[model samples]
Target: MATITSASLPRPATRGEAKLFAEFRAFWRAFVAKAFNPYRPELHYMRGPGPAWRAKHVGLSPAVQSMLAEIRTGKARRSSPSA
Candidate 1:
């Protein structure tokens, strides 16, 4: 086995080098956090209905379609009985 020498050993970093390393570490951490972010807005968002839904609902009657349109447009009032 070869003997370990002082010259071959790793030296302690100076204050400036330590500060630079810390800054680099912080920057790398932030970069990784942003790059590997798990929160996907598109995945969680509601995109209304898809083509399959539209195809399935294509046979809706005109009266039902009109009622749905009214409800969607907020023109259909609640038919609650007055107390």
Candidate 2:
């Protein structure tokens, strides 16, 4: 499982402030994609595996993290594979 360092945590946004948060999340996701995706033709179409792996390993929140870990590690309550 991936570790959750403070540096990886996104800055907290207010309850209704969507603009900055949305942009930040988008930027973060893009950054993650570029970082994890292999810079080649074959892996080009497999962008989602990074996000899926993230959702399964380094989730956005603790609850999500736990759920993702369960799915990734295939515990008793394994979640169905996501497309």
Candidate 3:
């Protein structure tokens, strides 16, 4: 580690230096907001893996939905009453 000394420290800032520092800070804030940020679109519904996986299976055909409902009610009907 480097040793710290009083002589290595920066001199106190004058009024002009202080004003320039403030202006640079303001410019950086505005610049980063427009240029350095990622583009994230808004989602009206749930996001991420769980929601995505659930959504894929949740959209079932009418026939499939009816079959599922019947199975749940202990009345699953096999087409043609297989032998």
For model 3, name the residue pairs that clash. Answer: none
Provide the lDDT at 34 for model 2: 91
lDDT of 2 by residue, 1-83 (tens): 99876656788778668887888899999999998986778755754556667768873878878888777788533565566
Q: Please provide, for model 3 over 1-83, each residue's C-alpha lDDT reduced to its tens digit, 9 standing for 90 to 100.
A: 99977766788999999999999999999999978667755544545569768778778889999998888766545444657
Cand. 2 TM to true fold? 0.28
Report lDDT (Cα) of residue 59, candidate 3. 85
Error of 2 at 4 (Å): 35
Give the winner by TM-score.
1
Name the lDDT value of residue 17 in candidate 2. 84
lDDT of 1: 0.87
Which lDDT tens digits does candidate 1 get at residues 1-83?
99976666689999999999999999999999999999989889987899899988878889999999989766434565446
- Badly placed stretches (over 4 Å) of model 2 are 1-16, 40-83
